[model samples]
Target chain A: MGEVKHILLAKFKDDVSQEQIDLLIKGYANLVNHVEPMKSFRWGKDVSVENLHQGFTHVFESSFETTEGIATYISHPAHVEFADSFLAQLDKVLVVDYKPTAVEP
Target chain B: MGEVKHILLAKFKDDVSQEQIDLLIKGYANLVNHVEPMKSFRWGKDVSVENLHQGFTHVFESSFETTEGIATYISHPAHVEFADSFLAQLDKVLVVDYKPTAVEP
Candidate 1:
């Protein structure tokens, strides 16, 4: 079975202002607007209205036919630029990059 | 294949103090320490030595026989108490509960 990567999650730094955070997220969204192998890529403000938690600022999902495709995506100049910009405002991030071990039969 | 729930991710509120954040995470970990069907229970400070990102504070992965099991975990009394304390300090959270459409052959 081809590898299927699931989700990418990131958390921003506390010092970053809301406006800067919003701009950083939107700008990165624009950059990844058309990456090959990125089956899906969408992000939004944290939705948890719960008191102590700020939902993850953004969650991006993408799938690739193989692991190599994901590696390339990570290193591509365009992606690096996007990552650099996005990383600037983030203080924390949690990324779980895994290919489904097997598709459900 | 029986339902398979892969991951659970959460983000805490901006105003959360570091001590409180750590306590919240540790407490939740203990609450779910013995739940059946859970394959994993772990949390950590974000790690992305690359500048600008703090990395996700914690990531938890658990497997379940069905979505309902995961739901049960969500509504369990211990979970609620843990969540209440945790949510009390969080500003946002994103929850994605999915069953593997097909386990790989």
Candidate 2:
């Protein structure tokens, strides 16, 4: 029952517009308000100097307190509905969940 | 300058032993001690419900104060030496850096 990070890496289709993507991102962020178990949402564009991204351009991260929280968020109607529009624009996507473990220096 | 999260997703080759991976992960996390700009490190195995991982099995995240901090980390001798051994065990790897933008509810 530890915290989990749902990390999604996405590559938008070549023809998708920035405006369309922006709107989708806004919709994604708004899910936090609708889904009770989802604690926070953050996202970013790839900025690595290393050319190792394999075409993924964006990263979206969602945090939850436990595995059940993630299960709740994924099955929530709000998330399901939003994912439809979100997936339509993506040419490729990678999603993974992990319980973050701090590494002591 | 904004803070950056350097995210790396890796899939180890089928032949690589779990013992080897454990050692490699230890080396990776220890980079914070050797590299001045790498503030923190954490990692986790994929626990996602969705099968969108594209064969990637683990996530490694490093935090930095700025993009330039990441630049210093990437070029530092400790990181370079570590990455060579790390990459040799991987079948595939994807890396991306991004400035985290919080989405307010």
RMSD of candidates 1 onward, in order: 10.1, 1.4
Worst 10 residues of 1 chain B by lDDT: B46-55
Residue A51 in candidate 2 has what lDDT?
94
Can you write out model 2's per-residue Cα lDDT over A1-105, one digit (the tens) per residue?
A: 568999999999999999988888999999999999998899999988889988889999999999889899989999999998899999999999998897664
Model 2, runs deviating above 4 Å: none
Estimate, for each residue in B1-105, the C-alpha lDDT of model 2 and write its tens digit. 568999999999999999999889999999999999898899999988888988889999899999999999989999999999999999999999999998654
TM-score top scorer: 2
What stretches of model 1 exceed 4 Å from their correct place?
A: A1-3, A45-57, A101-105, B1-6, B9-73, B76-105
lDDT of 1 by residue, B20-93 (tens): 87676567657546566554454433332333223344445455676667667776778777767776665444
Predicted candidate 1 versus true structure: per-residue lDDT over A1-105, tens digit per residue: 465444555667778888987676566555445457555444533333222233355555456676666666777777788887776766656555554431121
User: For this target, which candidate reaches the highest DockQ against the unseen true structure?
Assistant: 2
